[model samples]
Target: MRLLHSKTLEFATFYGDATPPYTILSHTWGDEEVTFEDMRFIQKRKSLPEDLRRSPEFMLAFDAAARLLFPPNRDPEKLAGYEKIRKTAEIANRRGHRYFWIDTCCIDKSSSSELQEAINSMYSWYKKSAICIVYLEDVDISFPAGTWELAPGHLTRFAASLKSSRWITRGWTLQELIAPGRLTFYNKDWEPMISKYVAAAAISSATKIPPYVLATGQLHRASVAQKMSWAAKRETTRTEDMAYCLLGLFQVHMPMLYGEGQHAFLRLQHEILQNSDDNTIFAWEPLSSPMLPSIYRGLLARSPEAFSSTSKHQVERSYFTTEAKEGIRVDLEKAPLVLPSGEVYYVAILGSANGTKLSFGDIHHLKQFYMFLKQLDEPNNGRRKQYVRVMGIPNNAQHQVQHNILIFHAETICVRQQPIIPLNFETTEFSRFVLRPDTYSATGLPDIQAMTVWPLGLISEKKEIMIPSHSKDFTALVWLQEHFNSSVSNVQVLLKFTRFPRVGYWCDIITGKQWPKDRDSVDEWRKAIERNHSVKELAQRKRYRIGTRSEIRTVSIEPGIHADQICLFVNIDGLII
Candidate 1:
């Protein structure tokens, strides 16, 4: 760590444990600001006898020579950034602190390793500082020093000034404001406005940070999502710095990838997931209006802007922590709910506040924080289950009052942090439909040999449906519509996906002449098929034949593209079989 002498701006280096206490500065950079290399205030003194060197005569001559060494234009006093350091140094000296750290001139950012370490250690650096000084360039507030309380008039002016202060909206200042145990705010003229302890409430109201959190650097009490929300509105000059600026608040470290753009936030979340199992980390939604497939994104959020509403509520750890977090997977507490349109949406409970039983009844209401999830597809080959968030702006982040919700308790769902777009996001059934034909040998089945499904190239590419492969009972619904001839002879076939008895699938027709609107309407038909054609477990090498045939027409199920998909083929003989 590098420190600047409080009286003289001479720089010095200190290592771990050996470093002395120092005051730190936090301020938004202006159009003209000093940088690390700009702190070039050199005073040269010739070697002299101790008595003579300490004498006023020798000091005057040394000062004159130093002035001649550098031109007036090169003076540090001319830089807009110099005054911040000078004032911070003066305050540090007044507070009996010999050393102070100002970000602009303290660290050598030119060195990559040094910059990385400094960024990762920034939060701790501010936390451990003897004093944290914040300079607000937009406001000029000067009040009585010993009396900490602001008058009613002063309070109004202070709130208005703090509300519009640019320091509150900058990315780096978030951690700087929260990491320090002792902090003071100064206005444009370098006059003290109010100490953090004295104005924590006002500051919290303006900045949306909890008063207690601002008073002390006890970050563990806040959830990862909440901390992230504090940074959601903060702006950083560099695109990646938005995520980089938060290293200290989360207390996790990873190599900085400056060019990654929004992906840096993704990496930050992954890092947070590794360090802590706070489920709120996944509790964010985008602010933009979503397009068809864009709405179906991965569990991980794209950026902190998605967490705009996260800090509004107190999301805490659920009692079901063990279930929510597996060995490495993040499992959300899930319950299935039926919409008015009868679409099944799984409510993935993110994290609950005090009212949950896990809270031991600290508060009255039992609130469950959740987001609506529509299962897109079951976990393919034991991978993460795929789901799409319920589109449209959510009416509420919490579940509706008890009586209105009908929650079917189901096991938790494990999803990946990166995106898991449904396998057939933008494509149609024909694109994903997999069919393996059944070849007959010398069995003398003349009817089967001449069968073929026609117009395969004419299949429309517009139909969409969700398929689940989570268990042995993998289900999918596929439709086959005959080409329109303006004739009643056109048949609409509903191929109900059944068990893959062996290599071949066994599907029963749910409805014959006309397709029913919903799957529930065919409940009795499914039951009838179960009784008449019970699924017989076949040997691995053998295949099962399914589907009833009329004299003129025939329909049967074939092996699909995947174990979870259903593919249909039709054969029309001379008769209606």
Candidate 2:
């Protein structure tokens, strides 16, 4: 552990029991933070050549150099991040603490091992703090000390002040909120408004954390799903910090992989599952994109955001076990919904089934947690069949319940952190992308033909692209085709752009002539998917060999693509089937 001298603000390294009792500072990071390097520079500058120290006038003339040399010629307090450190140390010193810790300057983050160690031990560090000082620079309340009126709506002012506080909405601040039972919240002016104990109920209302949990710091009081729900709305500047920040809450530790992105959350869930038998960890349900689909996802969730509504959901841990390679196997409650094709989908009941409205819906019957799952054979792990989450199907239809003889059956399926196929990335940057045909190819095929694609539902995606939606839902239906052996034998492709909260760009390429009775595969698909009524008729217009069976092509969303960049890459050689 690293600490500052509180009086001198000089950094000192401590190990295990050698670490002294210190106060920890928790606050949202600024645009430019005072780093460990900055603290080291201040220390080194103190031993500067006596001549340079005496020549304050020379240093002031070169203002930039003065900042590097020492805090002079400019108010270091007004700079981006120094005032918080100085104030934190001042508070700690006044409180009779010898040392203090602040994330920006205490830990040498440049070293990977040191950073990892600090993060893994961060929870314990905060939990052991004599007092955790939370500085909400955005929260300003001019009301004098001891002026809080503890009435029904009286705390409104305090809550309103915290309404815009960046501290509550940050990923790292969550652990800082939970770990230290004895902590104080200071406003922008460094005025102590309330201790965490005094504002537990208000903080709970603001953060969706139970008041008791905030006051007592007993994590066991909340279920896994509830703990996960707290983090769902919090945002982390670094993508990986979303998962890393919750390490203390779950009492689990793992290596910090910065570039791993959402996979970091999956790894966190895996570690939590490994340490504890909490099946509600899988109870997260995404309020999915409105783009109609037969798209499927893996058993694991994409991110903590998916678990936002999981607070009310938790049940007995049922047959939950994770594996290094083979994936996790859990017994799920499978809904009886036979699809058009032989493809079987199971609307597995997720935990919170207590008539509480969740992501599924608020209707009486829709209160239970239901998520779509599709079972498949795992060739690597024998001829055994396992289930992956089915994405995009409407919730009402996906998990249909009737007073019929067929009830939910108990079935076991394997789940892993990795998604099944056509990995979906959650991003809002991709408002829309033009769907155009890419050059087709097959290894050693005689020839490949170029495809010309213009949207049939809308104008050429080139001109009419970036329109929010073609219909009621945020979806755009595009008509395209693939040429196989000859011009006569072609496959008609329908490219449906996902809704506003778009996942990776995907197109359900259902290539087949015959399908089950939703009445005739091609026509029913046309009628089935043309929901919210974007277009009426998409007739084949001529005879062509479409294919033998139905198949959906879900594509992974790549980052940094523009609306003009074509994402439709179709290989016609496979259409020969």
Q: Who wins the TM-score comparison?
A: 2
lDDT of 1 at 349: 63
lDDT of 2 by residue, 1-577 (tens): 8899888777888888888989999998986678777777667666567888679885555456656655554444445788888899899999999999999887888899999999999999999999999898887775555664344454677887786787878899899989996898887899887788988888888888889888899988687889989988899988999989899899998998888898898888878878877667767765655563344455567678888987766544545465645467765565545542223455566443322223322223643456666554444536335555656554444355332232455655675444332223332223444433233433333332223332333444252334342332233333334444554333334444443333334433333343234224455555555542444443212122345424333222232223212132322332221
lDDT of 2 at 459: 43
User: RMSD for each model, in Å, please?
Assistant: 13.9, 10.2
Model 2 ranges with Cα > 4 A deviation: 48-52, 55-78, 146-154, 324-326, 333-335, 339-344, 347-370, 377-381, 395-401, 416-455, 458-570, 573-577
Maximum-lDDT candidate? 2
- Determine the C-alpha RMSD for candidate 2 after optimal superposition of all C-alphas: 10.2
TM-scores, one per candidate: 0.63, 0.70
Least lDDT summed over 10 consecutive residues: which range in candidate 2?
559-568
Show model 1 residue runs off by greater than 4 Å. 40-77, 145-152, 289-294, 319-328, 340-342, 351-366, 393-405, 417-577
